[model samples]
Target chain A: MIEAHQISVKIGAQFLLQGVSLKILPGEVVAVIGPNGAGKSTLLKVLSGEWVPSDGEVWMAGRPLRTWSILERARRRAVLPQDSTLAFPFTALEVVLMGRTPHCKDLERACDYEIARTALIAVGALHLEARLYPTLSGGERQRVQLARVLAQIGDTFSIHPCYLLLDEPIARLDLIHQYSTLQIVRDFARAGVGVLLILHDLNLVAQYADRIALLKSGRLIAEGSPWDVLTPEVIQSAFAMSVVVIPHPYLGCPLVIPSPGPDLVPNSVDLIGRCKEKK
Target chain B: MGTPAYVLTVKSLPRRRRSISVLTILVILLMAIVLASVGIGVVRISPGQIFAILVKQVGISLSRPFEEQQEVVLVAIRLPRGILGILVGAGLAVSGAAMQALFRNPLADPGLIGVSSGAALAAVSIIVLGTKLFGGLFHALGFFTLPVIAFIGGLGTTLAVYKLSHFEGRIQVTTTLLAGIAINTLAGAGIGLLTYMTTDVQLRSITFWNLGSLGGTTWTTVGVVAPFILAAIIFILQLSRPFNVLLLGEAEAEHLGVPVEPFKRRVVILVAMMVGAAVSMTGMIGFVGLIVPHLLRLMIGPDHRYLLPGSALLGPCLLLTADLIARTLIAPAELPLGIVTAFVGAPFFLWLLLQDRRRGKFL
Candidate 1:
């Protein structure tokens, strides 16, 4: 399990995140949803050990994440930052192979092409096979980055359970790739892997995430399953906008319809999550 | 189904692990340059005689009896200085190459970063001040003053650059460049101020320092700078993988488990040791550092495994060639090696820039 205790992150004098505590168990795909400045990325940075929290610390597995070497952290977990750009003309395969950095034997180079090939297959980037990564579109790049992260997870791991933390992973991918990406994460969750994704598409979050951790202005306002967290009142309170929450036509998870209104917000969720006093 | 299927077919065929072929080539080239550099000075000595004299000194003669006068010319005068030139050149090139990678910037050069200016300052201070302090001691120690003071000055400036230019874990390339430029300009003006205060002979010394001649690079000068440069090269060659990780940007490099902060600090110091020593011996030779690794990268790839040693060998070769031309072009008058490099390298830089524009990409 991965968990944070009393985590607080202050950028300059402003508290971007404060006194937040959460634990994610195995087989959990928790989606964190928030408005633009709600610190979703900041929370992910803290979670992924990319940014150290000002007040508290994070524990991965059972030990402090800080105690683990960088290679150990990399072997156990992988991160996909939002704006991962491919600046080189390295082949897609070569790029996927980079994910094997932490575990590539001899500390020199990689041998098995199968791992990278398989990652490409897993992410469905195979036909773009010999294509230069710099030539790929933004969505294609995102999928390739995910494949690279997956390759890292697959190669560096030693059966201690792997976690994937993605920051706004699907925002640029096309719908089909987006659905496939979520499906792969769901399948991984089912296989007992831990996955935390920051998502803006609430409908997909409602459908795919096993639990939703609603955050607003750096504070976790609500946490629960789709049925519990996606109530119209909760959506209105979290986003400060009215949303018609109805059953999905097929999955019956809550479907989101933005009502684009103002007064529907509860005065309390904001006063609490906004003020962000110690609980 | 809409996902590009080709994206999944990653590089699976077993390719040759990027090996040490680059190192082997550099080694072979170094030996060849060592042989060639010995024969290239203004006094035309045959390659045969160069080696014969070199061997006789080692107590193994191959051909004719070693001529005392010729051996004196080869071993004592020309040979040591040539070796010094190559050492300083290769060391500065490697330092510049490593610094470029360490800072993750393309435009970095040994001369631009105050290493050369630092050496120049040391050289000038000695000429300006040593004459008084050492008295007739000046005549006995005049030869040593330039190298020692230049090295100390280079070291001081290097530390200043390190402190002023680092912020958090990042090397502010722009700030470093500006700081180096600012320091260099100030140092140059200080040179001018020192120039104003000195005698005619000291003014000539300052003027000559600015032009960057390889005139007095004797065996002892080579002896002083060679070990530092050689040690720095070995250290830098070991850092190629870290340089590779660094090319991916600091955040990404750290994610790949490279301790970016400490490694960058080490790189700057290594660079200082190399360039500080080199510039102390040779005045401000240019472009070997900026030009060689870049050309090598285009010929091979951006992989520093090839680039570092390639720069090392190529840098010395280019410097020796420039030095040879400097000697032969005007005969005894001798154009400065710095001028030769600017003449050769500026055209090449323009061509590369034009090529980048044709490809329409930012390097």
Candidate 2:
């Protein structure tokens, strides 16, 4: 389990995240939802120890976060950013091999090949192993990065509890791959990994997330299961839009159907129906 | 969690790094260049005489009356020049590789941090002013003070540039480039001022120093630079894997266990020292640092294990050839070393830039 205690992050004169705290348990996939500049990414960064919180602390498996070195932190937890660009035309397998950096026997050693190759198979990108990473499409690149992170954690799946913090993992993915990526996260949690994924799509959060954390202006506005926190009134107050909340057709979780923004006049070319198709 | 897994990966990586295989070719080429350089000079001694003189000098007794002219030309005149070529080439190239890695810029070179300007300014000062100071004081310290003053000047200018580039505890690329320009321009004006005040003979010395030449190579200059150059090369090579980690970006490198800030500081210091020594000895040899490593990267890929050492060998081979032309092109009239280096380095660098563009990571 991962827990934070009044985590506050201040960069220079501005507080990017302030006194926001939450807990993520094993076998749970939690998604934080908010508009742009709502501290969604900042909260994830803090929890992953990519950015240190200026106030309070983070605890992992009952141990304080800062007590461990960055290498140790990386070995136990994995983070995948929205987009990453390699400077060279590295092979997709080479990109995945980088995930084994933290797990290498010595700091001077290279990656473990067997573990890296196995991780590629786990992500089902084993066929693209020889393809150039930069030449791959966006969805393919994201999966390769996920594969790399999996290699870093190795088979420690049953031993060391790994926390996966995915920042906008599929913001640019197409319809089919979006659900496929979500299924990978769901499977990870089923194997006892705790995932705190940042997603803007409320429907995907509603369909998959076991718990929900609502953030606004760098603070935790609310936190609970989808049914308790994803209310139409909460959505209206946070995003300044009306929404209709109802049970998912199968999952029984709350669904947010957003009304148009206050000033956005309804155009004849509407987008709601096509967006609902994704759910 | 155990050491066994990492040992397997670490051992395998070296094999992959060594599989480039061209290193053996480069070593052979360097050896051939070294022998040929000793054989070819104004006197045009035969290869046999050159080999005999080299062996005889190493205490292998010969039956014939020692060829005084052949030994002097081969051992005293040509050998120093060849060694100087290798030292300057390897020093500049390795330093360039380090600078590129530190800055994460493929275009970075030894002179990026103002080492060339620093050396030039110091050498010019010694040529124009030191001849008057130590030349008038103690004649024993007269001829040598220029290199000493030049080294101090080179190191000082680099420190000044480093200070200017460092803002808010991080050295940003734009700031480094801007500071380099400022230092180079200021040093350029200083060089111009010194040139104006110098006598015609002193002016020639300053001019040749700026242009870079192994024309007047001596046993003493080679002795002064060779050990330092070898030491620096060893130091830089140790950082090869660390440099690969650094390519992941500073935050990521630190997270992966590299001490980024310390690495940056050490690299800057080592590059400054190597470049300072080279410039003080041979003025400024451009493009060896910029082009050699770049060509190596294209040929073998961006893995620094091959790139750094490959540049070290290839750089010397290229420099020796350039210097050979500089000495022999006009026959009795030698061209400046910088002229030949820049002439060769520019076209090669442009070709690399074009190829990088085709690869689509130019931006």
Best by TM-score: 1
DockQ of 2: 0.21
DockQ of each model vs. true complex = 0.24, 0.21
Give the local distance difference test score of model 1: 0.76
Tens-digit lDDT track of model 2 for B183-257: 888888999999998899988888887788887789898877776678878988988766876765665565455
B1-363: candidate 1 lDDT, tens digit per residue = 123335333332332233255556767877776666666655556778887887787899786654577787788878886788778778877877786786566667777777778878877777787757656655665655555567668777876876788886566777888888987998888888888889998787677677666776677788777777898889888877767666656766667666777887678767877876777667777777888877666555556666777788878877887877887788778887788988887787678768767878654
- In model 2, the Cα lDDT at residue A135 comes to 81
Best prediction by DockQ? 1
lDDT of 2 at A65: 83
Q: Per-prediction TM-score, please? A: 0.86, 0.85
Docking level of model 2? incorrect
- Which 10-residue span in candidate 1 chain B carries the lowest summed lDDT? B10-19
Which digits, one per residue and each the tens of the lDDT, describe model 2 over residues A214-271? 9989888989988877888788778878889888888787777887765656553456
The DockQ-based CAPRI class assigned to model 1 is acceptable
